[model samples]
Target: MKTYFRLLSFARPIGRYAIPYVIYTLLAVLFGALNLALLAPLLTTLFGQHENAAAIAKPEHFYDVFKMLNYYSMKINAEHGLFRTLQFVCLTIVVSVLIGNIFRYLSERTMENLRIHTLLNLREAVFNNVMDLHLGYFNEERKGNIIAKIAADVQVVQYTVTGTLQVIFKEPLTLLTYLVMLFIISYKLTLASMVIIPIAGFIISRIVSRLKEQAAAAHTSYGTMISYLEEALGGIKIIKAFNATPYIKKRFHEENLHYSGIMRSMTRRQHMASPVSETLGIVMVSGIVLYGGSLVLSNNGSLNAAAFIAYIALFSQIMRPAKAISTSFSNIHSGLAAGERVLALIDQQSQIKDAPDAKPVHQFREAIRFEQVGFAYNERMVLNHVSLTIPKGKSIALVGPSGAGKSTLMDLIPRFIEPQSGAILIDGQNIGSVTTDSLRALMGIVNQESILFNDTIFNNIAFGKPGATMEEVEAAARIANAHDFILATEQGYQTNIGDKGVKLSGGQRQRICIARAVLNNPPIMLLDEATSALDTESEKMVQDALNNLMKNRTSLVIAHRLSTIQNADHIIVLDNGNIVEQGTHVQLLEQDGLYRKLIEMQTFSAN
Candidate 1:
């Protein structure tokens, strides 16, 4: 019940649709009952067949539908000819049906609008929460599961609100309206026949007993299947290279089969509820014919041939609402299970939220200082008491072997990952005390793998600065050595770059990334092996662009090749999560330490 209500809250201003829906549904039910009740008048009055016609007195209360109908119907028949009375009753029944159908259409339309509004709010909420989560969260959780919750589970949850409406208000009220009319015609028969209702409910509940559990399992399995799909798409190159096509296909097929089996089981159970209820309703109707027909034939009871016939019609329709309610229970279980997954995503809190009193930083004046900073990943230490200073307008290089924590150290400067101990300060102000947006605004980053959107070159270059003109973009492109290659393309700067810049070569892609960073024009730059992935010819071109980009900016670069950082102001050599040496290229060579050994190894590898 709690989960059901929480999902409904997404349909905010629910009264906008609720009040009108209730009114329309009420009118539909009222007129629909009249449509059936008029059968009694047609049988009794028009045919001139009631034995006690003389005893028919005017009903005192206006609410006495059956008595009023009988009184007026007989009055019309006597004053007017038989054909005229038939016209009056038939017209009344026709009008009742038309009005009833109109109101039903209106009620259904209102509910559809409510479903769309709820879906809008729920999808937006899930996406907004997802975008606000910290980077580490994406690393720890599967992307497919997140995508499924945002896209698929949210879809399932919206229908839960509709199901809830049917269970609580729409179907129940309709059922009540039918029952009230049945009791009015013959209360004794109505009272005696209520025994079959609870029995049908108990039997239907047993069939859908496991739907909620299975639905939860199905959602999990779906997420897993989606995860497998993502992995297959992302690693297609590796799969083909190793000839693992058969293995991958077999693995995916097994999960697909499992998910399909679960859905089939759920469908079988969900579908059984309606038939079971309908069959029980027919059984109840058979019993009513035996019991109530005896009362009409005896002629001593209130149940007449006309009224007994009307009673049976009303009783048959009462099962419709009952059947709808049972079907909704099945839907509600599936929805609530999906609702739990979507709500869990919305409930996720980002660990890297700003402090309440965090200040906004605008510019960098002095150096970025790391004072005894330490960090670890899952109990494995990556950086230990690391202290470094990158002064304003100087390029400092960090060179190390694999798993030496250089990238992790660079990530700490931007607060991408916080240090376990100690503080990093920019111009004497603690970075942790500043807003993440303002802090990140002062720096530009470039990774080894070029990250470009599948958009035109002009749009990609001007991504962050939305209002940039062509002149400004051309200037940035010129600085990164990409302006000539861009203009040489068929569409020039307007050329569409395929996914992740696949349309361009490695060097061309790297130049585009550099151009993007240059357009932002931050004073602090972090380059993570920016030119290491390029060939000799491409590397030289990118190296020159890097030289131009770092002319006066304070730069912290992770140098994969020792030759690239030989000209750096200060080079920090690290091994085993600790800085072993710090000096210029010549001074480092004089030390005969880990720095000298690395230079020799790189030189040997190059030869």
Candidate 2:
């Protein structure tokens, strides 16, 4: 019950959708009770009681119902006029059925609106939280699990919560109204019937408790399976090349088997609830019939036959609501687990957020400086007491072996990862003092692997400047040497690049990324081995474009091939997160240190 209450909290903000639903559900329940209650008078009339004798007699004592019926039947010629009364009874029953169906329709429509609105908000909030999470969170969490929370788990919450609320409020009211009708017919019989309700409820409570545990386990297993599948698909090419298909298949099978096992347990528990509840209802109904018949026979006219028959009908109606309520509890338990997951994500506070008094910078000028910067991934240091200064409009090249912290240092410029022990000053202002959005707006980055969407070439380039005119987009593409290739295609700038630009060659994709960065025209540019993956011809073409793009911008280049940055204003060599050499390309070679070894290796590899 506590878990269910927690789950309902997710619907609080969207209560407008739910409020109307509650009203309609109540109205529906009322109509359902009215439908059953109408039958009581009809049955009395059909039994040939006098038309004016309070056919649906309100019971004063248990015997008043039976005495009045017996007295009226002796005077009225019921056998002669039975068909006329039967016709009126059937007409009233039809009207009652019509009302029940109409109410049911209204309840269903209301639930639809609530379900759609609640799930929509929930999905949006989860996705927005994912986007705002710190980069470090992604490094630790699986992307597939996050997606599952947004897609699958959210849907589960929608159906479970809305359905549970509907049943809890609507069905109980229905049961209550029917119980009232039963009491009116025979108070003693109604009380006798209720004796079995608690026992059935206790049994259902035990079953649903176990079901909740299995439901939580099932959701976890499903999430794990999705995560594994996503990982396998993302690396399928490597798996195939290495002939590791059997290994991945075995892993997937294991997850699937585990998921299946949990689902089987959950289903078994869920299926038991309805039958056990209904069977108990039957036993109770039989008891009511035997006890009421004994009272009638022993007391000799103590029970009115017509009212007793109506009471039995009302008692039977209880079984469905009882079954529905038990099932709804199981669903509520499952939904609570999913609700907890979504709330956990929404409640996650980003480690990097703007300070209350943070200011936004409109322009950037002067030098960018990193002073005594230190950073770590867990306990392992990636950057140690690093310091560097690059004047405005100068190109600085970072040359290092792999794992030498070149990329890590570049990431700090955009505040993607903050340093633990130092401050980065952009244009003489500490970047920490400015809003992250404002700080990142002053920079552009192009990585070795180009990231493009499945959209038109024009849209991909225009992504950097969302409102850029076609002329501005064309000019930027020309600067990156991509305009000619783009125009050579059938649809030119309008051509779709397919998924992640897989439709383009490696060099072509790299140029598209460069064109995107060029369109931004930021004051600072960070290039992370941007040309290392290209062939000789493509590298030359891209290098020329990069040279043009670097002009008059404060650029930070992470270069693998030393020749690419031979003309840089200042070149810094790093080894094990420490700067080992700093000077011009020629000056660094003169020292014959790590820089010279790298140049010698690249020169040998090129030959």
Candidate 3:
């Protein structure tokens, strides 16, 4: 119940829909039960048993509904004849049904609106929270599980939460209305029949006891299957290259079969509740008929033929709502399980957030100082006591072997991950004291992997600047050496680059990335091995573009090729998370240290 109520909070200002729905549903239920209560009067009129017809008077109390209807029905029959009274009764039934159905329709439409509103809010909240989470969360969690929470689990919560509300409000009102009519007609029979209800409820409860557990497992299994699907699609190239199609298929098929088995089990249990409740209802009805018929046969109670028949009719409909309530219990279990997963995601707190007194950074006038900085991953230190300064309008190149914490250091500049100890200052102001958005806005990045979207070449280049014009994008492209090839495409700048620019070649994709960075034109540029992944000719073109992008910008370059950074104004050599050398490229070469050895090795490998 706690989980259920928490999920419902997404439906803010619920009274906007609830008030009208309650009004319509109450009217519908009242008229619906009144139709059944009028059956006795109709039967009495048909039998010509108008013993008190001449003395028929208006009922003094409106609560004596059956008497009022019977008295008027009899008075009409005596004066206007049997055919007219029968016609009048039939017309009343028709009108009652019409009004009842109309209100029911209105209530349903209102509920549908509420359902749609709740779905919109819930899905938006989950997706927005996901986007706000820190980068480390994505590394620790599976993509498929996140997708399931946003798409599938949220959908389940929509139906479950709204459906439970209907069951809570509308169904019980209908059941109560029917029960009141039955009690008014014959209290004895209604009391006797009440015994079977608890028994039926008890049986249904036992049958669905394990549903919540199974539902939770089924949700997990489905998420795993989705994960397998994502992995297969994303890694199709590798699977084909290694000829592992059969293994992948078999693995996926096994999880699919397990999911189907759990669903089959859950469906079996869900389908059983309805039939069991219905059969119990039939047994109770039989008991009511036998007991009420015996009373009519003997001169025992206030029960008469007409009223007793109506009582039996009203009692029979009690199971429909009863069955609905029982079925809802089973369905709510699934909903609550899914709701927990969604709420868990919404509750996730990002490790990185703006400080309470954080201020926005506007300009880059001086150097970025890493002051005795340290970072680690689960006690495995990635960087230890590292300190370096990247001066404004100067190029600093990071050269090192693998596992030298180069990428980690660059990530810290953007506050992608916070350091364990010490501080990083931008122009003597702590970066942590600045708002992340403003801090990131001062820098442009081009990574080894060209992160282009499946969009037009124009849109991809002008991504950061939303309202950039054709001239600006074209100029950026020309600066990055991408303008000539972009025009060679069939659509020129409007061509849709297929997923991650799969439509373009290696060199074209990298230049597009550089063009995007150039368009941003920030004071600081971080280029992480931007040309390492290209072929010889592609690398030369991409290197030329990088040079254009780095001109007059405070640039941090991570170079894999020894030849690329030999002219860097200042070179920092990192090994085992410490800066072993720092000087101009020629000065480092003359020292014959780690920098010289790396250059010699790369020179040897190239030859």
Please identify which of the two predictions, 1 or 3, would achieve the higher lDDT against the true structure: 3
lDDT of 1 by residue, 1-607 (tens): 8988888888889999999999998898899999998998888764556344456778898877988888877777777756776788899999999999999999889989989999999999999999988888999999988888888898888777565774678788988988889889988888878988888889999999999999999999999888889889979999999999999999999999999999999999999998888889889999899989989888895788888988998998988888888988888888999999999999999877788999999999999999999988899988899888889999999887788889889998888888889899999998999999999989888899899999999999898789999999999899999999999998999999998898999999999888888898999989999988889999988988999899889999888776568789999887767888898989989989877887778721110
Q: What value of lDDT does candidate 1 attain over all alpha carbons?
A: 0.88
Error of 3 at 220 (Å): 1.5
Model 3, 29-134: lDDT tens digits are 9988888887988998887466657786778988887888898898888788888988998899899999999999999999999989999998998999999988
lDDT of each: 0.88, 0.81, 0.89
User: What TM-score goes with each of the models?
Assistant: 0.95, 0.92, 0.96
TM-score of candidate 1 versus the correct structure, residues matched by position: 0.95
Ranking by TM-score: 3, 1, 2
Error of 3 at 124 (Å): 1.1
The C-alpha stretches of model 3 lying farther than 4 A from their native spots are 48-52, 299-301, 603-607
Each prediction's RMSD over C-alphas, in Å, is 2.5, 3.6, 2.3
- lDDT of candidate 2 over 1-607, digit per residue (tens): 6655655665656567667767766777766765665555566665644654334444456534334433344334244465655565567568767877776787788777767777777788889988998888888888877887888889899899877777877788888877776776678998888888899899989987876677778777788888888988878899999999999999889989988998888888888998999899889989999998887677566576666776777788878888899999877778888877877888887888888898998887789899999988899888899999989999999988877888889888888888999899987888889999988888888997889999999999999688999999999999999999999987999999998898898888988998899897888899988888889998988898899889889899988776679999999888788888899988998999988898888731110
The predicted structure with the larger TM-score, 1 or 2, is 1
